[model samples]
Target: MRSLFQTYVHGSISAVLGPFRRYLPAVVLLGLLATALEGIGIGLVIPLLDVVVSGGSDAQGFLPGLLVSFGETVPRETRGLLIGGAILALLSVKNIVVYANGLLQAWIYGQAGHRLRTALARKLTAMDASDLLSEPPSRMLNIISNESWRSADAVAAVMGIMVNATAALILLAFLMAMSWQLTLVVLLGIAAIQFAHERMSQHFAGLSKIITDQNRGLAGRMLHLVAAWRLIRLFGREDFEEDRFAQASDSVRLAALDLQKRQMAVAPITEIAHATLFMAVIFFAWSLGITFGTAAAFIILLYRLQPQVRQIQAGLAALRGWTGSLDEVQWLMTAAPAEPVTSGHLPAPALTRGLAFEQVSFHYAGAAADRPALHDATFEVPAGTSLAIIGRSGSGKSTMAHLLCRLLEPTSGQILVDGTPLSEIDRVDWLAHMAVASQELELFDGSVTDNIRYGAPEADETRVLEAARQADADEFIRSLPQGYDTGVGDRGLSLSAGQRQRIALARALVREPRLLIMDEATNAMDLLSERAALRILEHRRGKGTTLVISHHLSSITRCDRFIRLDRGRIVESGTTMDFNEEQLARMLRTTGT
Candidate 1:
């Protein structure tokens, strides 16, 4: 919904000319010169037509008169060869320029495609989390992978309409100069044919939008199928997924067929209409007793003019078919708006005193107005200490963590570090001091060392091994065939749930962050492993700040204090001895389940 549409729609010719703008004047000049050369080549043919029609009488036409007065008193005997040679020369130059223009246009559009892809990628990375999440991931992927390229070609189609229109106009002017009477009749008929096609163009554009939407949906289905491949087999529902994919694909094919049928209808109908007009001009010339030389020249010009008109009409229809692509590229390139969230320029202060969320409240974009995911959520984790947040599923625990991580900004209130609004701190500087290991692991498809060193790419092997040892993963990792260099496979699927979580924890530890966040980080581990992981967390007690978000009481046994959330509200806050183990267990039994 957010886009550069207003700016792009006003310009028909961008790969909707964003990066190609600087070369516009040169490109336009070359295009115009090529078109002019083509027109001149066309005019040179007029004299040849006159020679054939009159069997060597003095040619009498505006163009033939030019050669007659072509900067010389020409001998009549050599006029035909002279005009013939001129025609060849003009055509050769015109074709050469046309070829070069084709190369330039191709490069311009290629650059546009490259720019569009890179720009969309940059925008996707740069957008605020909420703005990025506003649209479906599959749809975004569809635009970036497929639609951007199509949009570039769509821009070329739009340019085709422009250049073809110009050619038609120039040829029209030449027709009028030859004989306005005949030109008038021809113009009206051509106008009527194109007028009828105007409605077809609108329909084509409508179908284009539908196909674009359908492709986005299909992309979602494909991505889901790939992502859920194991799940589908485990559930024994491969047939169901196949049928679902088939239906979506069939729908896309039918829509495209309908569009192609409508598009193919343009050519024959225009040709038939113009063919009738072509003959009508011929018969009318006989009736008017126009001079033979002039009529031949007129017919020749009209013949050349016909294809240009056809190109304009056809390009118009095809351009309409690509309207969706242009719109999508425009959206992807500028979808984040001017400034979705306010950010500040100040450097992040060291976490000396504490980090506090004061009366923080946030809801998703389309959630209920009255009910927020986290409301009036006030809490603090002092420096050199750990705090535990216990909450049931959907109790806004992860939302709180996301806010803390600056993934999402609060709808109101402020998260301050050392009493400075966290929003005012440089985000990159803040992130460098923080790391998170959560229930949802994000292990990349790479070696164990690679995943551990992901954010800290320059981290050496000693740091990676030490981090893995801290997370209790070094032993199992060394047992694998490639040890630290073993490929994790897609999302680390080759590893067990516990193994992946340990790797994720190692990733967090490898950074040695100032504030470490562990959100259900030990859930996948066994009894011994979970206790060991909890013991490992205990080591950060006084050297750094730590926040543990968990439903299990054992996971936060070493925390300095605790906060409990029922739904979005912080229902309780206290030190460790405030609640008995039995009472804490009873309270958290249903938290994550």
Candidate 2:
């Protein structure tokens, strides 16, 4: 079980409040005003009952005395009516404040959720590629979409508890004014109930963790099922997949049910405890020879007080149940990598001398230390030169590209651009001068023009068309029903593989980058289209530096230089013309291509 203080002071709640801290003052003020108004309405009940029971003959309590003093100026027959009207007005004002407070809370809830989602997205963008790949996509998706909302809701629950606690204290003060002894007894009884309920907090927290784990598994399984539907059908494994999903779903259901059962039990236990306390107070009042009017008003106030206290208890339990989600959100925001990516303040210089890798070595986290991805390898591509990197699938070709892009920093040694260490240059300025089109193409759900001009949104239609023509994509794009306006489905699923690749190429080219990297960028195109794209690259040979990674021999035949990688080591490097037909055939055979 967690204490109320610990639950509210948890770091996750603070992180959730960071973005909306400015609006918190307004939220607190409205909550306080609403609570004060409610106390005033509850206090008015005393005078209303007194007016009814004694018919304006006597005024006993503080509120009753005040009403009596105010009524002296009015006629005796209308004193009760005047008190009743005052009660109605006070209740009306309290209701209005309550409504306004609800609106403010709703706004906070929505804005908090939005901020959390946006913050998580920005966090992902700032994270290293290796850090992101450490977790499954489904897990990240669940946190962004589902757990973010739960975390926001927990903050709202905390606010509700604060408001209820304030109202309960005000009512307690009123009860004490009426009779100190009765208020003390009632307070003692309520404290005992709260102490007993505290034991359930740990249980709720445990159940919440189990539910969170089950939800992550379920989400992962659903994504797998959707992505592998064709494989499942081909292998006749529909029943197997169904059973796996059912197990995940059932685990979530049972955990949620257990949590709900425990949560629902709290309300009943609190209600019974309060009911017994009410009867005891009634008997004590009788023994003390208390008046019926005084006792009735106190019991009415006590009855109202019970729910407010119960609400405080329930809110505490809710916060405990959400502890797991809060912890996840906090971890996502604060976790750092062993080798954090550092940004420099200096702007990157132009690549007049070109890029160089000086004995660079990189080992992915959790990989065997002895077998690095790229080991003690050094290379250079001069300005306006063309270089081809050819190797087998796992020969560290993509890893080299990633390092050059600064997506993954080298574990040892240095990468330099024009004699300056790459780490000393501003990442934004460096990346702005380079563009890459890899094997995987990512196109959003928009028109063809939108996808082509994605990186250069300010590019005019003329520039977009020129880039598309350079990538051999304009012909097919014009044949579509809406030409450049034709919609590309999610991830460009509406277009063929070749069309999608060409569009990606066009997107990269539209940036007019000084350095361009193509990693099997034209594998999906036909031989003729491939040749046409390569022609564009050849024409840019002396205008911009190009690094091509491919297994297709024809794609790199015209390169100024070549490097062959094998088992994370560069096995050969020389001018492209140095590789004769026999050597090229042997290299292809060794790589099994």
Candidate 3:
């Protein structure tokens, strides 16, 4: 009981005072005035009812008892006018107070929602790339959109209940003074009903947790399936996808239905207990010989108290789910980034020298020992040179690129640029000098110019158009109905694979970085387009550093040097023409291009 009291008080204080800190003094003053008027309204009802039932003039019985209790005496006629006028004044004041509270609550709710969303968005934007990839977009959206709103609603509901509960308790105290025995009976009945409700609340929390987990899973799956619709269609696996989605959706529905059943049972059980108590209170009141006015007020107090009791229980149950979700969100927010931490700026580009990797080794966490991805790899590329990593599908080519870019740090040994450690460099400033185009293309829903300008937002029109021309994307983009202003659909679904790749390449080219990394960048392009892109890359061989990860021998031939990896170890490294007959045959068999 003490724990619950503390939680209730803390929640109320946080909601009413903390969120509205600047307006606390004014809100409190208004609330106090409102609560006082509400008490007066409740007090006035007793005299008004008394006059109707007792055949009194000007509600003669109204002010006398209260005035006498306060050690005052007055004539009946004067008392009647004073009490009547007091009741009217309280009613008017109560309405105004209610209006003020509504205004204050609205303002507080708006500010609280804005603050929470801003904090959430800020946290999300600062999170590392690995963290962003591990969680689905819809789950993040659910937390930001639905869960935050739920928290706001819960806070508002609980605060309103607490305020109203205070008022109810004060009115109950007045009724108790009129007849202690009747008050005891009513209180006992309410306590018993509340005990039952507490039991219901405990049971409901278990169900609520199950329902929440299932709902999140369903949302995540639906978002994934929708995003992968094209792959599903190309593979002719619509039925399989539908069944997978149906299974997830059905689990969510069943869990929700079960929780609803449990919740629905609570109302009837509470109502039965409350009804039995109300009857017992009436029986006891009559036996104790309470007056008509006191009886009327006591019954009215029960009528008000019953709903409040149920609400307190239901709100507690609802809050359990909310708290559980908040804890999950906090866990996500506090999770560590996937990559290793480094404190300083990234090393300067090799420029006039070379980049070197000495005894590099890395294996993904939790992978089987026998299936380690990369082990003891050693390689180097000279200044103004392009290196193409060539190997079979399971080879460590892409892993090397990730290591070079510091997306993932080596498990052992060092990677150096111009003899400076890669770990010593700052992430943002280092990444600014590099452009990476991975196999998967991400085209945001925006204009062609916007997408091209993504790499260098401040790049002028001449720079953007030059990049597009170099990427061989200028002709296609200009052919669009709106040219550079055309909107790309979600995830670039509106564009063909070749078109999307060209646009992405254009974005990277616009940056004119010190190092350019391409992983299967030409896989989507036709033979002619791939040759055209290679011609463009060759033109800039001495201008900047370039690293290509490809299985295609033709692409590797375009680079100044070729490096081959076998089980993560660099087995061969030389100019393309120096490749042994065996290496050339292996490459031809692997890629068949």
Candidate 4:
């Protein structure tokens, strides 16, 4: 709702252009040269017209009374030649200078946009998981793809408009010096019309925000549809999906229509204002019997003034709309996590001993009092030993794993690595020492080798193959048409669910973390594939810490000890041998494979 011409808008414009401060002088000089040339062209038209109209024996040779009545003292022939040549040269220079200014402004704009996107992306990527999860991907995508570029473009447009408008006003002032009465009438009339246009700009600015938000929503909806196309088709929900997307698209369309209507309304008003002002000027000039040169210059000045008025208004409106979009983008980038968070490489633990969760309690962000996800859950696993957590659905096993990973900090309690509390450790380094493979795997569109190497970017091809072999993915990968170079379609759609899981495991394994967490990592695998995966896990068990969260009782039997969670509490804890026949049956029944 703020005026784009306010002080803050000016300050922001200054800040956005600050980086290009060094180039300002060059750009301004170029603009000045162009403006000067334009002024010269307008002022030259009068004398040129007079010369063409005047006729004598000297006119065929050149001209007569060219300087006599034209307020110059040069000879007729020389004066005519000078006036003609100056007009042509000024016109040519004006165009060339204008072109140069355009290129300079464009380069500055592109650089500013690039800097914003690169800086934001670097910050977002390096942020800890807690910080990264604060906002949705759709919002981030919108800021990076559109808003940043929009800000840069608005900065450039506003600069160009300001320079040109100032020049036009200066020219108008010069014309007013010649005839104040005519200038006053034209200026006041134009001012009234511009004020009306400004009133309508408020509506367009509001619509701009809605349009941006809706377009972002539309993109999110389309992405969801594409992601779940298989399920939608199976359920015959094509029409349902289309309707939902249409609703979002329709919202965007309506907002655009509102802006378009306002813009259209502006066009006619501006045209009418220009026509009336011109007619009034001509009427006054004809009555006074103005000289040929004076009338010609006045008309040229009028032509120049109209465009400047229209552009200044349009540029002001766009600047407001762009600022609103920029605010949304800034909000998204600065969104806080559900809690305070920090990021960087964590300090290495002096002892490198095992991990411990001391009376840890965590509740979901928004949940009923009776429905805690993890409550008074105390547990510990020795370093380098594999621990399995087994529980039925809704038993908070995954929540426990998430807490361990620091994706969600415990509401009240402490998790320690060795002797140091996790909160004290630097986030990035702590996460680096751990790796996880969950039920859902996210794979990008890239070669198999590229995907595997993601876990350890510096890993060699040999290391990549070794990790794939460990996850039992190397064979299938090689059997594919391109082997390790085979492309994994978006989200690994080209691979089966089981294959995707294996590849995900390979990605994690390649990191060779001190602690590896697997939350239902083999859920999509067949019995044989599960067996192969367990062997791969066991093969590296003694070398590093492995924690598996699963519903499969058989899987935990291989673990040295198992913990069971119920209603956010660790209801039972003991070795597999400690389970009585009844207790064992109860566990199996609850899992109910």
List the global CA lDDT of all models. 0.78, 0.80, 0.70, 0.73
Better of 1 and 2 by lDDT: 2
Q: Look at candidate 2 and tell me the lDDT of residue 549.
A: 86
Better of 1 and 4 by TM-score: 1
Instruction: Write model 2 residue lDDT over 88-115, tens digit each, in one string.
Output: 7877887787788788778888887788
C-alpha lDDT (0 to 100) for residue 105 of candidate 2: 79
Give the per-residue lDDT of model 4 (tens digit) for 97-156.
Answer: 889988998898888677666766765664444444434667667777767777677777
User: On a 0 to 1 TM-score scale, where does candidate 4 land against the true structure?
Assistant: 0.85
- Candidate 1 has its poorest 10 consecutive residues by lDDT at 2-11
Q: Please list all clashing residue pairs in model 1, or write none if there are none.
A: 14-17
Residue 233 displacement (Å), model 4: 2.2
Candidate 3 residues 1-593, lDDT tens each?
A: 23555333334224323556666455556655665675555565566556533544221133325623322233445655666677788879878987987788778777776776676677676665445644667777767765666656655665566555655566566556556776677777777777776766665545655765776777787777877877899999999988888998899789778777877788888888888888887888788765565566567656766776667666665665355354444544455654546735555654567788888887766567776567877778887788988776667887788777766777788887777778887767777788877657588999999998999999999999999998899998999989989998877778888888888888988998888888888888878668767976687688887898866667777788877777677777789777765776676575432
Name the lDDT value of residue 246 in candidate 1. 95
- The weakest ten consecutive residues by lDDT in model 3 span 55-64
Ranking by lDDT: 2, 1, 4, 3
Greater TM-score among 3 and 4 belongs to: 4
Candidate 3 structure, TM-score to reference: 0.84
